[model samples]
Target: MSSSSVRGVSATPVESIIEPLRECMVSMGSGHGKETGDRRSPERTVLGRVASIMEVFNGGQQVLSLGDLSDRTGLPKSTLHRLADQLCQVGWLERDPGGYRVGMRLFELGSLAVEGHRLQETAFPYLQALAAKTGMSAQLGILDRTEVVYLERIVVGPVRLPTRRGGRQPAYCTALGKAMAAFDGEAMRAVVSSPMPRRTANTITESFALWTELDQIRKVGIALDRSEAYEELVCVAAPIRDSGRAIGAVSVTGPAGRMRWRMATEAVHSTAAAIWNASFRFGSAGARM
Candidate 1:
């Protein structure tokens, strides 16, 4: 073939022509196909920078100064100030006397998620029925990262449980957490990656052991917390899924003396199945995660 025809304009080899095209692509905000750590997405929008700033404020650090946020987020102080001011104005973040913190408005908005609020309403009747049938405290909980957040509850028994609506407990030690984690691969990976704190002597601290238990829960469709989260507090739980994807868990809790495995599992498993059949929806998050 003629060089002009092969190379489009010059006598350059096809390989040489292709190399410059690749370089042009690299220079034009296209993917570089680099190593995973170096392949960061191009910063073309403010959403990423704003999210990075918000990620700096975690459980241990609820509030952070502009300087601290800048250091954590690696954003320029001028940009940080501008974004922070906008966030404050929009009620997404709050400016304290010395630092900024996540605003309650942000939480209120987050609570309105269809997966959470709508799921709570759909599961309430089942939770209430389980509580009445067993005379135990029943709860519906959703996994939030590595923790379980109680979304709905039915209180019946005399025992005082520590978890209230909107309360969080470690997923590795709670029956609800394990039940949800058993069916969701992401939740399982998160549990294995994090250090499992021993909430009680029975808490599964070793990753391998926890993995084995999760496997069993997946097969049986139920999980038991035998005095794991709190001393003498036993729980039996089963996962509630939407279209075969676990969105949350249903659990019954009581003192260890009364929370027998055969009895509690039977109740929780059936109730969870009923919830899945009746409340499964197309747009909820738990349907996939």
Candidate 2:
């Protein structure tokens, strides 16, 4: 079992995992941290190696041994031992009777993400309303590069989905991702700049077609998943804007056979608008969109 599963750990997005490391690397290596700049010094190499080891401990496989990490990271046992021990001492990694797992330090650090916390808090009541009204699943998601990181989920009935809180799904394929990207120029550019991977047969991998769909989403203020992100699952999402910028999205999801997509869209859009309005009214700085 992945160490995360063994410890019943929640999912963590890749961006969140890398953010702290980026700060640490910038502070330790570069005098100025340019978000776009690439630093390839010896220290960066070490950080890269550390990232490699850390990346291996995901939902699929959470706990690992010195041997397992060495095999996964392609580092020598001696090197792995020294590095893992150092990480353990700093509480970034923990050693167990079975092996090494991600430490609570990561959770503590992740809790400090302001945007995520704000979205979760601001969107929760609306999410609950969406679930109660739609009798499906409602989720809050944020764009993290080419993926949407699920921040909160509300499931009314017993429905199984591949995604969970903090789990990621390709932005190019999900309604939540498309909705967020449609309102953000930078998000649109980043998503279409690269080839979208095929998740399902119905997934839109063509950049041109995706661009067209995004344009429609921008005009309509909603997006359809149409079983793109997962087979047989449909979703309708609307952008949740903060101060006129797309900070995240809210979505309702269900199996295609049972959901009334049109009705769901209305509920999703209304809920998103409610959240957006609430955010402006309650958020710090007193900004509105």
Candidate 3:
């Protein structure tokens, strides 16, 4: 101080102290900058990890243990446990004795998405009527990545079917899938390229055979599933079209021996037509599904 205070002019200026301090601060922060840059390209993000966890349930598995999740996701059990706990907190997952299952929140969100589009609501009555008339389950479905996503199902009797709304079945085997794919060129091509796992003896495993069947369906506006997806189930389906392009398909399903092919096909065809006509009243854009 004594040296700097001579004649009211400081020998050491305040700027000298501040400049070095600033340089030192920047020097210290360079490592933090590098860390920030590293974060920009992480190996895996939290959201991606969560998606990997959720996707394992998409196959309709009721529940999975931590070990099962670890096996399926290849994520460490420690990480999975933490993420699963958080997912359970947010209602995306639920814990069970065995492990965890998809929670009601997912179902609630799915319902909102389906009903928000109004397609499910619009098709419900027609499906109900079809189920009542045929004494079998009536389903509405749309093609999703070479699979048929069941949007709605109206079961008339105690038909112990394995399918459920929001469940997915292969587009190559299910009647609803075939009916929709028969008209949509992109969907047909997707089915052609995907693995056609034979679920039963009647399942179409060959591409040429499936193409022939699709061509026949396009000609008749009807598709049939004769124990192709399930040995006990037989179904008849018709596409709901708008100006020659299919938006969705409707099907009537019953036990193989109990299904009357002639009656089910006629009812499904008319039901699809009626739904297509009704869709215009509900705004055709929503029917795009």
Candidate 4:
């Protein structure tokens, strides 16, 4: 191998230096000995990649395989393995016989945010009572952006439902959403401006229709969802109000045509008010520890 001189300085042997430089180029390029056309971008940082990996586990996804992660995140298997290992070490993810899942540490961190609102504890008894009285599933939910997030649910009857604690449903088509949005003007405006996708044939997709329904809810102090969000489910809901706005909502849900509308409406209205009063007392009763 020949040495070269540049600017009167002697360089190392060319053969010895060239191989390391080629290896570095390949590592920087594509890690596959190919030109990176569009893959190189400043926005694709390590933090962004990590966030993408975390987001792929959302929407009721309990666990995912490495291949599932790769497909959902659009990341290579080797990269996923490396990042997954690091995430598992940091308690952001866990490895199981099934595959990978969001770890307990992540749940602990998320609980910090939820702890500020102790609605679940306050509303659980009322939800249980409502379910027992109505022979239907009862739920407590709050408006989050343009969706309703269920904080608690109590099931009674044999009718299977899709709802679960921490699950989300579109605010425009669900009874809980309508009950809350009826009082929150900002939430209603957000729903009006946002896209209202039809989940079933009965969903009220038109802005005017939704506005009318919300107005009706305001007048009656209850909202109804008759197979709007789901094909075979019906729900009745009322808002837990504070300062003329809804802080949360309560609902009784059951199979379509099986619910006694008047009885369900009365039950939800009382349940919502009961929950509101209990939550108020609970908050006031909090003591420093």
Model 1, residue 211: displacement in angstroms?
0.8
Candidate 1, 1-289: lDDT as tens digits = 0011111112212222233333443455434444446554533335546656655664377788989988887889999999999989987689998789876555433433335666787788888889988878999998776888889888875777788998888899999999988887877989877898887788889999999999998888889898988999889999886445476889999988876678778999899888876654432223452
lDDT of 2 by residue, 1-289 (tens): 0011111123353345655675665456554333445544423355666776776776467788888988887888988888888889988889999889888776444432445666688788889989988899999987766788898999867788788988888789899999988877877888887678888889998889999999999888999998887889999999876435576789989899978888998998888878877766665112223
For model 3 the TM-score comes to 0.61
True-structure RMSD, every candidate: 19.2, 14.7, 23.0, 19.4
Off by over 4 Å in 2: 1-112, 284-289
Q: Worst 10-residue stretch by lDDT in candidate 2?
A: 1-10
Structural RMSD, model 2: 14.7
TM-score of each: 0.63, 0.62, 0.61, 0.61
Clashes of each: 1, 5, 0, 0
By TM-score, how accurate is candidate 4?
Answer: 0.61
Lowest lDDT 10-residue stretch of candidate 3: 1-10
lDDT for model 1: 0.74
Error of 2 at 118 (Å): 1.7
How do the residues 32-90 of candidate 3 rate in per-residue lDDT, one tens digit apiece? 32345544212145555676677677555788999999999889999999999998999
Give each model's whole-structure lDDT: 0.74, 0.75, 0.76, 0.74
lDDT of 2: 0.75
